[model samples]
Target: MSNFVFVLDTNKQPLDPIHPGQARRLLSSKKAAVYRRYPFTIILKHLSLEPNSTPSQIKIDPGAKVTGLALLQGDKVIWGAELTHRGFAIRDALLTRGSFRRGRRSRKTRYRQARFLNRTRPQGWLPPSLLSRVENILTWVKRLIKFCPVSSIVSELVRFNTQLMQDPTRQKEGYQQGTLYQYEVREYVLEKWGRKCAYCGVKNVPLEVEHIHPRSRGGSNRPSNLTLACVPCNQAKGNQDIRDFLSSKPDLLKRILSQAKRPLADAAAVNSTRYALLNALKKLGLPVTTGTGGQTKYNRAVQGVSKTHWHDAALVGETPQLQFLTNNPLLITAKGHGVRQRVITDKYGLPKQHRGRFKLSHGFKTGDIVKASIPKGKYAGHYDGLRIAIRTKPSFALYPKNGGKQFDTHCKYLNTIHKADGFAFSFVGGDSSSA
Candidate 1:
């Protein structure tokens, strides 16, 4: 199976997506023409389409990091993408800017009026780091709607509960007590060790309930002494005290003991912005349905499908089964518009150089998808969404879509395929032709 081919009528009105084979036939028979490259959309040349179309649903698996998206018609998944966010990049950029500003102000400059508490955030204001996530998702959804008749949306609002998973007995014993009785020993141990082997830090492996103190040496089975460790680590540390075993790695031992006393702190920060995402989705005016990580996991398990973002997305919503899904879905990285207009600065917060005001050069800009055919040159081949830097006159520095070595290419040899849509494209699981 492959991604659903986006369809459009002669008037450019949205229509239900068709199979790749059907799209191929239409292209071969000259009934349709390729409209977009990344999503593989086609527009009808002459055929009149009805206003009514099949109801298509967009499923989203929102996460603190990578987000999963899928477009489904009936039980068939037509399009899927794993949207990688640059929230951390945005945060780092802001931090660098702040550091530079602070450094500049501290160096023999007249004191300015304090701006603290003067600037007020408007209602529903979100930090740029968080807002970037919401905007990225919205951008894709809007683009999809322009090509396909999307009727509804389903999104995963929250991940599975850590406490419930760590201690299953809590379901019956209530919040205060569980099977172990003393402060939910298993849950504490799992959280304290971060559900991974304490020594190796290997996760997703079967972890054995371990004792920091050797039981044979009078180590109690209390929650304070319990920790999670992989089978290999447990065997290696058999009958040995934790401090003695980790004597060579003093820092690791200190970190483990220090973290054990504190609860997980990052979860709250990750989840705080999700409600704002949900609200943004609702503004699209579609009937939005929400699910939890537990439900998504259950659905995926029942379907016997391998774990992937697309599979998780297909399993979302009220759909009973997924009749078809692409063996290789497109992997899209949301590289925001290459429009940084700041002057380059040195390490000491001094301006090193000024950037050019003009964005266009030789009738093309960076992030533009282009095809180049140079008969005799080092940079000779087809390229898509290659980021370019116009340093010289005829030749420009070209960076490959996928991370690799960059080279210079002539402007005359390059043909613009698509204007940059504020995204960088790459294929995952298989070749681009499979999509």
Candidate 2:
């Protein structure tokens, strides 16, 4: 299965999305034409159609780094995408700017007034790092709703249970008597050990459920006795006592034993902004339903699907018995518009050089997407971006958008397709030309 192809009537009015096969038939018979590449939309050439649509739902699994999105009509998943955000990038950029500013202030300069508590954050204000994730999801949702007739939206508001995850039996018999079951113990042990061998700490190795105390030597099958060890470590340990084996590294053994009894803390930092996202989605005026991380995991386990963001999205929120989903989802990386104003600077905040102007000599901005066609020149294909190193009248070098090969072309044959709206374009396994 693949994404549903968007359809439009001859008058350019929106219509119901059809299967990719149907869209192919229409295109082959010259009944429809390609409209967009990223979303794979199509438009009718001569056929007149009414504005009718089927009830559809959009499911979003929001996360700090990667968000999963899926559009479904009943039990069939028509389109799916994994949106990778640049939250860390935003954070790192701000930190770098702050470091530069601090360095500049410390250098030999006139004394300035000491600031004290002058800045204040507005209501509902979130750091750019966290807010970027919410905005990216919202932007995609808005764009999708415009193309498809989405009736309802489903999103994962809270991923994990903070209390239950931190102390699995917090409500039960308190800390000392709270013991996890065998299966639960294994999961907790793996996480506590960082999914690595407790003996060697080598990650990415196949780990085995090993007993810290030899089971033959009266070691109970409790979580405290259970630990993760690689195949070599388990074989070497055999039935030997753990104390005798790890006598050289008392600290490592003690750390492993202590951590096995304690549960890993929930990621409260990343989940802090989930409520803001939920409220923003609700403001869209759609009937929104929220799910939990446990429910999503249960749904995926019951369906026996492999772990992936898009698969989790398909399994989220009132899933049917049988659902059709795409094998390859569209990969969307949210690269924000290059908004860096600083031109050049050395490592120690010393200014090396600066850009004289923002626009190129040919009047094209740095991020504008342009198409260039040269009848007889070195460069002839489509190129985008404002990497015009030589802005001479005859030809100019163009850096391609979405990490493409840069090429040189003449300005006379350049045509503007879509102006860069503070965003970059990079897609794979879809149509390339624009409408």
Q: Rate the local accuracy (lDDT) of all candidates.
A: 0.74, 0.71
Q: Give candidate 1 misplaced runs (Cα > 4 Å).
A: 110-114, 160-196, 202-204, 208-228, 234-248, 258-266, 317-319, 380-385, 392-394, 429-435
Summarize candidate 2's per-residue lDDT along 196-288 as a digit string, tens digits: 898898898789989888889988766567788999999998999877888898998788778766645323434767888989999999999
How far residue 50's Cα lies from its native spot in candidate 2, in Å, is 3.5
Q: Give the clash count for each candidate.
A: 1, 0
Best by lDDT: 1
Find the 10 residues in a row with the least total lDDT in model 1: 175-184
